[model samples]
Each structure stands twice: as structure tokens, then as C-alpha cells.
Target: MNFNEFELHEDVLNAVDSMNYQAATPIQEQAIPIILKGGDLLACAQTGTGKTAAYLIPILDKVAHEPHQHTAALILVPTRELAVQIDQQIQGLGYFVGATSIAVYGGNKGPEWDQQKKALSQGADIIIATPGRLIAHLQLGYVKFDQIKHLVLDEADRMLDMGFLGDIMKIMSFLPSPKQTLMFSATMPHKIGDLAKRILNDPQEVRLAVSRPAERIDQQFYMAGDNQKLPLLSHLLTQVSDTSMVLFTSRKNTVEPIVRALRKLGLKANGISSDSDQGEREQVLRSFKNREFPVLVATDVLSRGIDIDNLSHVVNYDVPRDPEDYVHRIGRTARAASKGTAITFINEADQKYVLKIERLFEKEVEKRTIPEELGLGSSPVFNARRSSGGGGHRDRGPRKGPSAEGQGNAGSKKPFRRKKPRSKSAAKAPSSTPTNSAS
Candidate 1:
């Protein structure tokens, strides 16, 4: 249905018109009214479904009808990128309505925080902040949430995954107990469900676009070993020349190396990770969207919020730790009813993830071989590449020789004996085990 049919305020309708947002996405159509009615909402929506605008539009409308100088609405997000993204959407949809909002997150200059606080005191109606940073502001008596009437947890799954549950509870203690709570997640994990129970009061659940990949996406996989991922990805990008693509890495540390390696191969590629500043991240995204950069490398953090129109392909350079993230990463390409391709790199470590993903999509993703140029054709499968004789990052560098599977060229006659793949339960330690923190 169209935005006009929702009986939004004239200016909101006008803002939608100016933004050229004619039809409401499934999430928007399902969520706008539920939130406008002051009901707590638990929505399951992937990225690229306009989920951000779904709640933002109604929140702005509420603020327009009853303007408040106090922080009337509080939005807690997991990362600064998402905080900025949601704030931007609020501006775009609420521009004509004159709704005032502020984003408070870590990594901002102290002066920026001071200025933002000054604006808050002068009556910023809505506040978006990361959990840790927001808690710090509250502890320092810089934030006034006593007047909060609404609360939102965007990417609830991410928040829980990032170990923000305690911080979330702490923040909730400051809000009015009677306030409306809206929780949005790409997937509803067990923890998310439990958190919703504790926070939301008999919430209305919207399962719009529930756990499904966008229909326009043609999902497939490229089978390779862990070490072969980057080389295959670089080769694939060359094969699909001129297409805008995102390469998804599971770890933040992998982004830069992948970009550097791709560039070494003379490809126009760049990377973005959590460590990247807002300016640099935005530059990479803008360049990719504008076609100045054909390939953009990122982690799961970028998978959900980034929107690039007509992005033709998604390359999963690393298997997502959570299978659900796999769907969101690929969904980036096939948006707005446009067709796109989603190619994932599945190594032995990812075999367990493959089955779960297939079940999620309810279809077997087409498995394809890596390009022969990358040496998947050598005599031995584990054909080790000639190394630079150094360790560390160089040790993990892409291999250079061909595999023995497809060719019998001058290669070692030794058989490639791959160790049996480990079972999922044994592959990873228990969730409570202390793994290194993601940067």
C-alpha cells in the first residue's frame, strides 16, 4: 500500500512524496500503525526491507503531534554506523515535520558531545545512542531520560550478540516503566525473545519478511578451502567485470587484507570495518555506489545497514558466524524488487553453516567451482602456494599454485589429504568461552 493510504500527516506524506517513497515496504506497512498506536512491537525483518523507515516514520509523527523538549524517545543501537544510519533516516522522513533528533555514540569528539548535549537541553525530541556511550552519559548526569515516553532497540539480535544485555537492562532502569518499547531484529534468537519478554509489555509482533531472503536474489555458493577464499573472490570479481559487489568477511581484521590483496591483483576495491572512521566508511560506500569502486569489502556490521542501489552481487568472503547473518548479507543486493546475485565462499569451516543456510532459504544453493585461473585445477587439492618465506599475515596470504583436481601440470605427485571436517559442536567452544573480542 502507498504511504498516503496510511493516513499519515500531510507533511509526512509530503516528505514521503519528495523522497519518492511511493509504496510502503512490508515492514513499513505492518509496523507504522502498530507503533503509531503506542503499542510495543517485536518485528522480524531483514535489512533492505525498509525496516528503519518503518519505525522512524511513526516515531516522527508522534513527535510532530505532541512536541516535547525532553528526550521523549530513546533508540539504543549496537554500533555507531547504525546509530548514524537511523538518525539519517529520521532526518529524511521527518525533515518537513521539523522533528529534532540527536545521535550520541562513542568516537565522537568531546566538543561534539558537548554541542549535542547543549542541543538536548534546548529540546531534542529524540535521542539515538549506543548502549555503552549512552550509559556513560547517564552516569555523568548529561542525559535526561526521565521524560522518555518511547524506547526502541534496533538490531536487538546484534545488541544481544555483542554482550549488551546488561547495559540494556541498566538503561531500561532509567526509562519510565510505562513507556512504549519497540524491538526490531533481523532474526529472533532465543535471547532476543527472552529480552523482549522482560522489556515489552504484551507487544504486538510483526513477522513481516520473516527470515526469508529477498525473492529477487539468485543465491549460490563457491566451494573452496579457507586459504582459497580471497583468490577465488578476486577471480570471481574479475569474471563479473564492472558489477558493484560487496565482499563480506566474518572478522573485522579480514577486511583490510582482502582489500589490499584485491588491489594487488589490480582490482578497484576498498574495505570498511568497525575500526574504520565514519568518514572513511561513508567514502567507501559512496564510491562503491557511484561505481567509482566496483568492489567494497565489509564485515557483518556493514551487512545490515548499508543500502546501495542496484548492487549486482554479494560475495561472502568468510562464512558468517551466525547463519542468520548470511541471509542479511545477501539481501543487500536484491532489493526493491530488483534481481541480484549472492555468492558465498564455503570452506571446510563453513560446511556446518551451509546446511543451516540451505534450510533457512529452503533451497539448495547452486555450488560452483572456483575459476581455473586461481589454480583450482592443480594436481593436488592442497597445492600449497609458493610463499614469500615470511610468517604472520604473509603466511595467510593467498596461494599461488594450481590444484591437481582439474589438471596434471608440472606439480607434486603427492596426494592432497584433507583432514576430516570437524563437527559443529566441536568446531567452536561453548558460547560462554572467552574468545577474543571483535574489534
Candidate 2:
């Protein structure tokens, strides 16, 4: 559907044209009219489905037309990067419409906190915030939500995974109950359903299928010894030089060392992690988006954060422990129907995860033998397979790259494998994931 179909204001139409957005995505088409009609909404859409604009455009339109001075909309996102990204979009789409906004997240300096406080106390059309940081602002007693007519929980599933459900409830208590509430998530679990029930009243649901990476993403994997993963990654980056890439590890501390190692290979790479303050993180993301650097070594901290359309490569330097994380990471690239590449390095320790991921994908990603010349010993357990890149590929010597393999279109329809029901399982996945995305 076109923006012209909606009863949007002239300023909004101008701004949308300026942004070169011609049509509404499916999520936008389905959800915007309901939201404009002042109904609560529960939308299930993945990252690349234009879900951000689905909520933002309508809210900005209403705020722009009504001309509110108080905080008109409150958006709670999962990470600082997402908050910043959404705020930037509001600024862009609302540039001519004059919609004011602020991104409230932790890890900022005192002056940053002061700025946020001023925005909340004074007035803005919208306030995009992380759940925890917004709660901190609420505790200060300066926030005025009496005029907040729109509430959005962007990436609700991720917030639940991050254990911010309580903070969200606390923040919601400050808002009036009669306002329109919108819940958007990439996935719909029981928790999300429960939260939606508690928050939205007679909500309309726009449920899209789970999103997979772009079909153009040429996925490949390498079976490397633990010590040889770095060497293989370095070699693969060399082959795919001249395009932007995001390299994901499961740990934060390992981000820098891998970045340094990549730099030694004459690659422009930067690292971003949760430990970095707001200022540092923003700078890193800015440079990466500007193409000042061609590579960024990061953790799942950026899974939902880095939404660069031109990002052409994603390297799973460390196989993610959670299969959903793998989906979010690779989805960073191959966006907007663009072609890209996804590479994974599977050491013995992470091989089990590879099987699980393939199971989720419902098709096996071909396992490739690491070139013997590089001397990274094969996983003692993994039997080497024939090269599938074909042709004189075997004779490329030092330039021999990793394996190419993939399954499914974007994501899978089959349910993820479940463990047999057991009492007192005695083990659970860690939530903090400090190392899950870092190393």
C-alpha cells in the first residue's frame, strides 16, 4: 500500500517522499490503519520486515497532526543501539514534520543523562528508551507521561530474553491505562502473548511469518580447529574484500583481539560491545555505517542494533549458542532484498551448535574441509568433506576459502527441536551472555 492511501498530513507526506519511501511494507500496511484508528496492536514481524517504520510512521503522523508538547509516544527497545537507531529514524522521517524525540539508554555520561532528563521534563513527541534506563528516569520523578497516548514495546521478545519484563511493567504503571498500546516482536512466545494480553485491550494482530536471511545470502561454513578459526576467518575476509561486514563472536572481550588481528591482515575493522559507553558505541556504529571501516567485530549486542542495508557480509566467528541469535546476526546483512554472504567458523566446541542450527534451518549447510596448507588441524571428530566451491578452487593455495552451504529461504517453518521433558534439568542457558557474542 502507498503512503497516499493513509490520511497522513502533508508534512508527513513530504517527509516520507524525502526519505524515498514509496510504499508501505506488509507490516506497515496492516498495522498502521489499525493504529491510526486508535486500536491496540500486537504485530509479529522479524527484523528486516520494515517493522520499525510500521510503528514509527503512524505514531509520528498522529503526533505531528495533533501537535503534542508532552511525551506523546514511549517506545521501549532492547538495546542502546536500537534506541539510537529508532531515534535517528524519527529525526529523519519527522524532519519536516518537526517531531521531537530522545533515546534513553544506560552507559551514558552525566551530561547525556542531563539531556535526557531535560527532554522528558520539557516535552517531545516521542521518547525511545531501553526498559532499564527508562525506569531509572521514572524513579527521578521528573518524567511527565500524562500526555503519552502511544506506547510501543519494540523487540519485546529480546527484552524478555534480557530479563527486562519487570522493568517494562514498572514503566507502564506510570502511563495512563486508556492509551493505545502496541507490541511488536520478531517472535511470538507464550511470554509475549501474556504481556500483550496484560497491556493491549482488544488488540488487532498482524502476524508475519518468521523472517530468514535474504535468499541472495550465499552461506558457507568452515570446520576449523579451535586454534585455526582465526586464520580461516582472515583468509575468507581477504577473498570478500571491499564490502562491509559484521563478524559475530559470542563474547565481548574477544571483540578487540579479533579486530586487532583483522587489522594486522590490512583490514579496516572496529569492535563494539556492551562494555563500551554510549558515546563510544555510537561513534563505532557511525563509522561502520559511513563505510569508514569495512568490518566490525561484535557480539549479539548488535544482532538487533546493526541494521545497515548495504552490509554485505556476516561472519559467525563464534557459532551462537541460541539458534534465534544466528537468525538475527545473519539477517544484519542481505537486507531490503539485497544479495549478501554469510560465513560461519565451526570449531569442535561449536560443532554441536552447527547441527542444531542446521536442524532449525531444516537443511544441512555443507561442511567444508579447511585447506591443509594453512595448517589449522581439522576438528578431531569432523570428517573432512570435498570442496564445493568447484573448478580450480582446490589450487588457489593460500587463497583457498571456506565452504559454501545453506538451507531454507529466509527462516524455517518447522518447530525448533525440543528436549525431552525432564524433571530438575539442573542446567539452563546463561542469560547475560557476556561471552556468548564476544569471543
User: Across residues 110-137, which tens digit of lDDT does each residue of candidate 1 receive?
Assistant: 5767756665555467888899988877
Model 1, stretches more than 4 Å misplaced?
238-241, 371-375, 378-439
RMSD of each: 13.5, 13.0
Candidate 2 lDDT, 169-267, residue by residue in tens: 899889986899999998888999999988889999999867455577888887754445555666665556468988887766667666655555456
**Minimal lDDT window, size 10, model 2:** 404-413
lDDT of 1 at 207: 83
lDDT of 1 at 99: 68
- Compared with the true structure, all predictions reach lDDT values of 0.70, 0.74
Taking all chains together, the TM-score of candidate 2 against the true structure is: 0.85
